[model samples]
Target: MIRHILLIKFLATADTAQIKHLQTLFEAMPQKVTGVLTVEWGVNNSPEYRNKGYTHSVLMTFADEAGRQNYLPHPEHLALKQVLRPLLDDIIVFDFQL
Candidate 1:
């Protein structure tokens, strides 16, 4: 199995509505594309100081490395990244085969 995890940090002025929309779009990707075992997304609502800067995370599970590769360039995935790129300060992607 393969896991694709994305951690994103946004500038405070970033469009919250658009962020939510992108989260929803990404969460639905497993249903739209092949080889996805599971997908999840969440916003940082914790009032804790730990993630004082970073705001959101997306965790995706794939059947294998090939599944993750397939997911990467999928049209919908690209579209979501386009929607998010402008608002984000930084994005970190981690993939591991388990």
Candidate 2:
């Protein structure tokens, strides 16, 4: 399995509503894509740090690389990104072979 992790830092315009919408979009992927085993998204609830205002994240799990490859350009994902990119300040993506 592969775990595709995306850590996101939001811009000022990205508010609670945007995060909720993004989470909703991501939650749909597991059923929509063939190899997706799990899909999750959320805001940071950790109280340990100052947060640096870095707020949102998505963790996508797949059976393998091919499953991940298909997910990258999935139309629903693309459409969500159209809303995502403009509101995000920074994004870091990591793929772990598990």
Candidate 3:
């Protein structure tokens, strides 16, 4: 399996409603993408407070690189990015075989 991890820092102006909307859009991805095996997301809860501004984390599992590749430009994913990209201050992504 391929584990894809994402960390996001929202812009200060994002506001609660916008963030919630983004989360809702993200939650809908599994239904839109057949290659997605699992999708889990939440606020960063580390006590260390050393996240460097990243406020949320999303973990997704895919069957392999091909599945991940298919997801990258999938229409639903692209549409979600159009909404999310502008609201983000920074984003970190890491993918690995598991």
Best by lDDT: 3
Q: Write one digit per residue (lDDT tens) for candidate 3, span 1-98.
A: 89999999999999999888888888887788877888888998899999999999989998888889889999999998999998999999999998
Displacement of the residue 17 alpha carbon in candidate 2, Å: 1.6
* Global fold similarity of model 1 (TM-score): 0.86
The number of clashing residue pairs in each candidate reads 0, 0, 0
- The per-residue C-alpha lDDT of model 1 at residue 71 equals 81
* Residue lDDT tens for model 2, 1-98: 99988889988877888778878888988888878889888778998976676777789999999998888888877888898888889998999998
RMSD (Cα, Å) for all candidates, in order, is 1.8, 1.5, 0.9
The list of candidate 1 runs beyond 4 A from truth reads 45-48
Clash pairs, model 2 backbone:
none
lDDT of each: 0.84, 0.85, 0.90
lDDT of 1: 0.84
Best by TM-score: 3
Model 1: per-residue Cα lDDT at residue 23: 76
Error of 2 at 7 (Å): 0.8
Q: Write the per-residue lDDT of candidate 1 for residues 1-98, one digit (tens) a residue.
A: 98888889987778768878887888788889888889888877887778747778988999987777898889987888788888889888898878
Location of the lowest summed lDDT over 10 successive residues in candidate 1: 46-55
For candidate 3, the per-residue lDDT at 9 reads 94
The parts of candidate 3 lying over 4 Å away from their true place are none
Q: How big is the RMSD of model 1?
A: 1.8
